[model samples]
Target: MAQVLKRFFDLIVSSGAILLLCLPLFLIALAVRLESSGPALYWSKRVGRRGRIFLMPKFRSMRTDTPVVATHLLEDPDRYLTRLGRQLRRSSLDELPQLYSVLVGDMSLVGPRPALFNQRDLIELRRENGVDQLRPGITGWAQINGRDELPIGEKVAFDVEYLRRRSFTFDLKILFLTAWRVITAHGVSH
Candidate 1:
């Protein structure tokens, strides 16, 4: 019953957001193409539920040739990030495209963020902890709490907590917290 309600809410909200953001997405795509030479959307393989592989779409924010590694692992991740990329990432606009994923049922508006295919350790931990059982999300408890700054262990812990306690009200609170976090520029590291 709750899952039905959550899915219904996901459909309406993600659909509405995608429609509203289409223009901004176009302009951002144009800017990225004008500033750099790569696809406007960057698609990388990500680990989804039950070890399923999916192509996660994000606004192209870094040099196309950047090695597939965690941003934190980069010597100077900022250097590879394009000029517009920084603002998009800082404002969380880079993640807007994932709304499409939600609409398509590959993701939810709130769940555990997907792990990169190359993130063996993170993936392993998530699998061990059953975090991979849930659909990946655009914004999540981990996202609102610590975002990129959180270690994989801490992130999985938060994700586990979310899985256990999630409810319609909890999701609403997380969404509200996400809005506040974005506005205040909290916990965004990169």
Candidate 2:
């Protein structure tokens, strides 16, 4: 019953957000293209619910030659960032394309963030902790707690906590905190 309600809420909210932000989304895509050589959107392969693989779209924030691994793994992440990438990442405008992932069944508005497909350690930890049962999210408890700065183990701990405590009210709280974090660029290391 709760899952049904959550899905309904996700659908309604994502739909409305897309409708309202369409123009901004378009303009951001244009800016990304104008600033870089690659496509405006980058399709990242991510591990979704139950270890499924899905293509998650993000605004292209890095150069075409950037490695496909998580940004933290890069030797010098800053060097790969496009001119507007740092600002986009800090402002989280690069994640705006993920609203479409939410509109589809591939993601939730709130839950554990999807892991990169090559993130074997994180994926294994999430599966072992039963976090894989929940849909991956656009913004999550871990994201609000410590966006890119958290260690993998700590992120899994937060994911497990979210799995245990998930509810509509809790989801709303995570969303609120995410907005605040984005506004302040808190916990964003890169």
Candidate 3:
């Protein structure tokens, strides 16, 4: 019953957000293309619900030649950021494209952010805690808590806590907090 409600909410909210964001999305895409040589969207293989891999679209904020690796793992990742990439990443405007994923049922508005395909440790921990059972989200408990600053172990701890306390109210709180965090650019490492 709760799952039904969650799914309905995800569908409606994501659909509305995508519709409203269409123009901003187009403008962001144009900016990215104008600053970089690659396609505007970066379709990354991300671990999704049930540990399935899906291509998640994010605005391309890095150079086309940047290696496919976690931003944290990159040695001097900033060197690969495109002209407007730093601003996009700082404001998390780069994530607006994932509204499409949420509308398509590949993500939720609130849950663990999907792990990159190569993040074995994060994937293993999520699987162990049954976090893989939930759909990945554009924003999540971990995201609101520490975002790029948290260590893997700490992130997994937050994810497990979210699993234990998962509720409509809690999801709403996280989403609201995420807005504040994004606005302040809190806990964003790069």
Best by TM-score: 2
Q: For residues 30-52, could you state the per-residue lDDT of candidate 3 as single tens digits?
A: 99998878899999999999989
Residue 184 shift from truth in candidate 2, angstroms: 0.7
| Each prediction's TM-score versus the true structure | 0.96, 0.98, 0.98
lDDT scores in order: 0.89, 0.93, 0.91
The sequence of per-residue lDDT tens digits that candidate 2 reaches over residues 70-161 is 99999999999988888899899999889899989999999899999999999999999999999999999899887788999999999999
TM for candidate 2 is 0.98
Point out the worst 10-residue segment of candidate 1 by lDDT: 181-190
Candidate that would win on lDDT: 2
lDDT of 2: 0.93
User: In model 2, what lDDT does residue 159 have?
Assistant: 96
Q: What would you estimate as the lDDT of candidate 3?
A: 0.91
| Candidate 3 collision pairs | none
Error of 2 at 181 (Å): 0.4
Predictions ranked by lDDT, top down?
2, 3, 1
Residue 186's lDDT within candidate 1 is: 88
